[model samples]
Target: MSMARTVSDTRLIFGRYLRQTLRSKVAVVFGLTQPLLYLLLFGPLLTRLGGVRGFGSGDAWQVFVPGVLVQLALFGAAFVGFGLIGDLRSGVVERLRVTPVSRTALLLGRVLRDTVVLVAQAVVLLGAAFALGLRAPAAGVAVGLLFVVGLAVSVASLSYVLAMRTRSEDAFAPLLSAVTLPLMLLSGILLPMGLAPGWLDAVSRCTPFRYVVDAARAAFRGDYATAAVGEGALVTVVLLVVSVALGARRFRAENA
Candidate 1:
């Protein structure tokens, strides 16, 4: 019964978040529009450029869709901590501190909420990619979800780290951009390793984004990149652990 109640409550909270978010019509459109534009406008454009030799394809656009979608899905991670920031500024966090609710759940709910948002973005953008001639077989859906969750967990964990330490939205802008940009470039969204310069490719390989992209692309092609998948998962776990620990420590210090 307690488990059932927890699920019910989580659902309600999640639903409330969805409704409130959708009500912000401008924000909804803005969040989803740019990704679609990139897919529609640049998908074919990049394809024509020819893929890098190492990437194993002449169709660069075809090679790009899965990785790009996952990369873009991380977009929402920047704002994932905004709710906590609001709660802090408004003193709601203080009220919750005295409550019986789970601390893990508080963070988990936000992470899950952002996951839904980011995954929805991933689907729409990927669907557009498919419409533009990027093929993803039916079975790809299962792997797609795995890729999405991996991206979401890493992203939300980052947001938690930021929120626990930084209170201002404006203060978040530079940091958020810094976090997302390098990942985007290094992840092979626009330029895969084959196309990248030697030094750059070496750096890119060190990033988990490269692994996620490689794994996601392989899944789409019906050949899993098992090594990349394992590496991405490993990095994601490490990042999540570090972020959670930092957030917890900072949360305690600030409250004290």
Candidate 2:
């Protein structure tokens, strides 16, 4: 009965944000524009590089698109905290606190909405990639999409937790950039980590995001059954669990 109530509240909150997003069509288009630009501009230049040292042979788009998709997930989901901060400032969160909605549902609803938005962006990203020259098996493409949504869930939860803790966009924005840039750079989202110096490559192994990027690349290459894919999926699941738990705990503590 308690579980059913939580689910019902989550659906209600989810519907509220889903409708809000639908009303802002420009935000949806702009969320996809960065990846699309990278696909058109930076992508062609990579193809000219012929063979990157550690990257396997393929049309560069096959390699580049997965990286861009993950970047899309990374940048978009990590910034979701800004919206939460806005809610807090506008008293939206304070108003919700008086209601009986599950605190977990509050965080889960926002993260789930973020997941949906990022998945839509990923679809548009893949469409542009296909037009450019990317060709992965449908199953592989599905895997990549799953990876994107998993990443969205994990990142968005963590972002919201940080927003709650900081309670100020001024503090949150720079801190988020500091956290995300290092993760993005070391994760090899743009280039293979193998190309980095031996020690730098070794250091990347410490970041969970590296596993996710590897998993997406494996799926892009149609190597779904590989060990790397298994490790990547494991890392992503663990991240989602830990992040959601942290975010929910923070929300409950704040409201309590």
Q: After superposition, how far is residue 160 of candidate 1 from its true place, in Å?
A: 2.3
> For residues 66-167, could you state the per-residue lDDT of candidate 1 as single tens digits?
766766667766667777777789887777656654454456556667777777777777677767777666676567567767667767767866876777
Per-residue lDDT of 232 in model 2: 92
Candidate 2 TM-score versus the reference: 0.96
Determine which window of 10 residues in candidate 1 has minimal summed lDDT: 247-256
Per lDDT, the best of the predicted structures is 2
What lDDT score goes with residue 111 in model 1? 65
Model 1: what TM-score?
0.85
Question: Which pairs of residues clash in candidate 2, taking residues 3 or more apart in a chain or in different chains?
Answer: none
Cα error, candidate 1, residue 172 (Å): 1.5
Question: Which candidate number maximizes TM-score?
Answer: 2
- Least well predicted 10-residue stretch by lDDT in candidate 2: 55-64
Model 1 sits at a Cα RMSD from the real structure of 3.0
Off by over 4 Å in 2: 254-256
